[model samples]
Structure formats: structure tokens, C-alpha cells
Target: MTDGLYPQLADAFPALASEIAELLRADGEPLAEAVADLPYYGPCTCTATCINLLTAPHGSSGSSMIQLERDGMDVI
Candidate 1:
């Protein structure tokens, strides 16, 4: 992870670091990998947002594939 990413994540969602780390490890999919594999051309209109590889070129697809849910509610 980049230095900027950690700070950004810490600021955006303070409680999700551990959860994110676990997911990344369990699936053996790092953030960069997830971002790279994301479907750039799709009919997904979900308003959620995430930081991934596509953002580097597509400049914020205005949506996120990873939906952070907590207590039965979507957090992201």
C-alpha cells in the first residue's frame, strides 16, 4: 500500500482497516489487484465508491464494486 492510501483510508473509514486487511489476505487479492480486475465496462449504477486501479486511468468511474456493509446497512 502507498503512504497516501493508508492515510486516506484511515481518514475515510477509521474502523475498516482491519476488515479490509483481512479480506485482502483471505482472498489473496490486494487492493491493486482488485482494482485491476474490476469490470471497467459494465452496467453497474451503484453509487458506492472505492479506490482501485481503474481510478488511475478512468478517473473515478463514479461507482465502486466493493460494498462495505455493517449491521445490515451499506457503509460505503
Candidate 2:
């Protein structure tokens, strides 16, 4: 429902729509919701590399937990 990909896929691949839905759902949660809180970098439109989150800290553990770990770091 978030985007037309689902319906478009459903139309093209009726038999595999359910499986594709599962992949997009991200373990029962909407894909958008799962990634909404993550940070974003520049689009970098001039080059092949576009916008992307620094995923090193935002894995399954979640952003807040990763922020906590970063906060503990002490630089001299």
C-alpha cells in the first residue's frame, strides 16, 4: 500500500506476489516503518553513489542502541 510496487508486482506475477510481499514486509513490519528512523546521507546526484545511511551503526540492533554505543566513545 505504501507504494505501487506491490500492486504492479501482483499484476505481473500473481503467483509470486505473496512471496514478494513477504520480502518487502521486513519480518511482518512495513518496509517503510522499518527504515524510517535511520539517518540519510547526500543524494550525490553527480556520481553513481547516491544517498545512503551509514549502515554500520544501524543494523538489526536499531539506531538508538547504536547511538548509545557511540556516546560511550571517548576521544583524547
Regions more than 4 Å wrong, model 1: 1-7, 32-59, 62-76
Candidate 1 has its poorest 10 consecutive residues by lDDT at 35-44
Please list the residue runs of candidate 2 whose C-alpha ends up more than 4 Å from where it truly belongs after superposition. Answer: 1-7, 23-26, 32-76
List model 1 lDDT by residue over 1-76, tens digit each.
Answer: 3334323443444355456555555556566334322232322334456344222324354554665555666554
RMSDs, each prediction? 8.8, 13.1
State candidate 1's TM-score. 0.33
Query: Candidate 1 clash total?
Result: 0
What's the residue-level lDDT of 51 in candidate 1?
40
Task: Write candidate 2's Cα lDDT for 20-57 as tens digits.
Answer: 34444533546424343223321334446643323223
Tell me the TM-score of model 2. 0.25
Among all windows of ten consecutive residues in candidate 2, which has the lowest summed lDDT?
67-76
Q: Which residue pairs overlap in candidate 2's backbone? A: none
